[model samples]
Target: MFVIDVIPFARFAPAGALSYRFNEYVLPGTIVSVPLRKKTVPGIVVACTSVRDAKESIKTAPFVLRSGAVTTTGILPKSYRIALTKTATYHLLPMGVILREMIPEAFLTHGFPKKLFAGTGHSLSFCEKTYTLRIEEYKKIISCTKGTVLIVVPTAVEIDRFADTFPSAIVVTGALTQKKRLASLKKIKDADIIITTPKYSFIPIPHLAHIIIERESANSYLTVARSPIDTRIAINALAHERSMQTTIGDYPLRMEIRPKPGSALKSISASPIKIFDVRKKITQAPFKALPEQILSIIKSTHEQHGRSAIFAVRRGYASTVICRDCGTSVRTTDGRPLSLITVAGKRVFRSSNGDTVIDAKALCDKCGSWNLIPIGVGVERIAEAVRNNFPNAPLVLFDTNTIRTPRDARSASTKFDIPGTIIVGTEALIPWLNPSNPISLAVVASADSLLALPFWRTRERLARLAFSLTERAEKVAVVTRRPDDAIFTTLENRLDNAFFKEEDSMRKQLNYPPYGHIVTIRIESSITKIEKDTALVQSMLKPKTGIEIPDRYATQNKVVRTIVYKYIDIQKWSDEAQELSQKIYRLPPNITVRIDPESLW
Candidate 1:
């Protein structure tokens, strides 16, 4: 018999390794099943030793392996395993949770179809590359690199197109089925060139050399499902650990990542953004969702047999309905404002979660009065306005309500191929637009609406969106009440560098992320329990660390969210992160912790 230390791959468990007894020796990183609390659980072997000599060292080997069969033969290469640990600790998540993300379900359940070799040597060379000539850069990499090259994109929908662009590259993404994942895994084993999404980027390639992270600014890279992890940062860590060359490229490039000596930079000119100020007109005329100037642009485009798009921040018919007299929004039982929309020619009130539905004309839930009104226009409202204004034009809605799949989104964008078409959509439409079917005109329903969001990165997000829209279309117009806002002028002049500089300055002034780390501690339980837990967690903060409790609020679900910002020197970040994580872990299970959360709200 042999004693092995393994970490169980179970959710909601403490971050501790357990020892198990096995008849045969198992390799570190091997996936095996062991008994745990009257049930069998899968675990990764960290270390193993023969029982004859190790039994004295290990007394409480609580469980024994059922069989000597290794469920998964492929081991996480040592460097990748270290990267996973560092990421988990950095994100304040259980190591198993990060491993769960790195390894597919197929690998955990069944052994690899073929045994793989793990390379222990590193290249010992690191550098950064930036490129403005996207196609040319890809060609250069393809022609120069002899070893395996891994290319990671923002979404799985883009993988097919990228694979087509590089015909010799194999594709892998989270969207693949079980059979397809296995097939892709097999293909990746021998392929020197691969194109995949961030979901499958962790799989070890024996001859991996370079990693290219496209669209580095994409919000999709910052996954928030279980643990909020910046995939770009994780990929960069992996590349550094492997000593490989890395390139991160995006339009209106991210200013934070410093450019290395060997970098390809570009000078992009800005597009003039037209702003239509409507504050003076709203008081004189009835409230129109789209200003007359934007409407005229759309009409002119239609007259020219051109396509246009209207971008709205919200998705429903009416984002929320409110009481005019009481000033109270009509909320669901859970406290979320009810959205008003029409379905099958019948007006209805729907909850944000789509679980509750009521009559659109129902009295206010709070005041029981009939003086209710829609607060703002959503995609449906914009669609209605477009249809009424341009009666002869063909229009399609591409938001959460209409888009059920990526294919649907692609099909909607293809509709713009025909002239005189108007597409009403949310941010989902951004990725679907291309040069072949570009919109002749792009309209922002309200710049004020985007700027007023609770997120701290509102300015940065708005700047990026404005840049993207203006760059993608021949003309761009923003209908807003605040025409004098500097952001509008920045977009109008296409001064991306200036905008980012101001953004960085503001972030540094406020000590927000990329300047300092924000660790959020959250608790979800009965109201009383949450209150007590949050108070306890708050009391445990060290006063000397200069940790600022910026915001602490409770949600409708009785969950309390608390954010604490730490702006210490860069050299001490990792140490403090580990300390804070350990402190939070010591709290009751009712509480959870996240470092550098993707969303602060």
Candidate 2:
């Protein structure tokens, strides 16, 4: 008999590997089936020992390894394995949780490897080096990079575009089918250049010696949909472990640039962005959602036979529904306020949760009053207003509600291709517009709404959007009640560098990301136990840096929840973060945690 430690697929079962007994030895990284707790489970073999040592350490009954054809899966390289363990420790999660995110359950089945190619055996030297580059220099680096290169983009659209730019490169993305993915993997087996989105950047390519992060500043690179693993950190770890060169390119680069000649990146050309003060308009038309100036601009754009776009902050018909007399918002059975929408010509109220839909005639629960008012504006509202203003113009409502599928999105874009057409959409429209095809006029329906968001990156996100729109349109107009806001200065002066500097300084001073790290913990349970659970978790963490103790609030399912924020020094926290996370992960079943959450909402 032999002793070995195997990491099971259970995400929250425990924090360490399980002991297993096998008559024969398997490599440490091999995938094997083992009998676990009266059930067969797949696990990664982490260690192996002699039979004599196994007999000496026997305490509980050891389970036998299931008889099967064991395949040594390259789910991770040696360096990647170490990085994953470090990530698990840093996030205070079991190795299984992190592994679950890396390897999907479907890929775990069937013992055979699916056309995975072995990367080059070139051993990387250990060194810490960072390079800053201008746009032209960045392009030069991409053009001059020898050996197999991995270019990681933020979106699928960029994947297609980059593949065209580097025709010699093979493309891979999550959007590919299983057959296409396999084909893509085979194509890159020996290719000198590979282009991919963040989803497929981990596929092993033997000659992969360099990595280029295109538009690293975009939030799409951050995997916020599921596990909150930053691809940048994973790529950095891979580069360090394998001795590969790496470069990050963006308008306002995410990393600090070294003081070197020709290091400062050049700004791309953009149309002039004009800021319009809507304070007077708001005073003149208090009841109207959109100002007369905006309506007139839309009408004039239609009259001039010019294509235009109006960007709104929200998606539904109305942002919120409230009781008129009580001044209280109508909410779902849960605590969230309901948003007003129109379906089949009947008014309805939908909660942000997406499932709770109520009739508009429903009385307010708090006051039992029938009189209610819809407040705020959304994409649907803007489309309706545009249609009213220019009845003869070709209008396209391009928000998520109207455009449900890829086909629908494509059809909308095709319709948008018509000249003199008007497209009213949410932020989702930003990715669809190509700079090569300039729109005549681009209008931000409500800049104040975006600036008033609770997020710290509000201005940065708005600035990024504004720059992108201005670059793609003949003219970009921003309507805001507060024209003196810092964002307006950047827009009016066309100052990308000044905005980036001010934003970076604010982040450093406030101890936000890129300077400091934050982990958010959310606990949900019965109202009575929610407070107690929150206290228990707060007690577990050491307040070496910062802790936010927000009050527990009620949500759907009558569940009360509280969010705990833990801040740590970016330089010193890695060593201690694993220990802190381990303690928090051991909490009761009612609680869940997220490291570096993209959005608290």
Best by lDDT: 1
Each model's backbone clash number:
1, 3
Error of 2 at 79 (Å): 2.1
Candidate 2 lDDT, tens digit per residue, 529-584? 76677678767774542244554345644464546464646777777776777686
- Candidate 1 segments exceeding 4 Å error: 1-20, 23-28, 33-43, 46-74, 106-132, 255-266, 269-272, 281-284, 496-498, 543-559, 586-589
List the global CA lDDT of all models: 0.69, 0.68
Which residue ranges in model 2 land beyond 4 Å of their true spot?
1-21, 24-75, 103-139, 224-227, 254-268, 281-286, 496-502, 543-557, 598-601
What lDDT score is found at residue 567 in candidate 1? 46
The prediction achieving the highest TM-score against the true structure is 1
Q: 1-601, model 1: which lDDT tens digit per residue?
A: 7777777766544466777667777777777776666666777877788877876555554554444443444566666767776777677766655766666555555444343343244332221222225545767876787677888887755565577678888877767787887787777767878888776777657677778777677777877564467677677767767777776666555545534211222345434568788777335455678878788888888999988889988887778898988998898766666888877778799987787889888898888899888867789889989988988899989998889988787777668778888989888777677632347888889678778777776776776676677556888888888877666766666533455556667767776666677666666566657657656776767663323343333355565555455544656777876776666657776666666554664
Enumerate residue pairs that collide in model 2. Answer: 92-581, 119-206, 120-206
* RMSD list, candidates in order: 4.9, 5.4
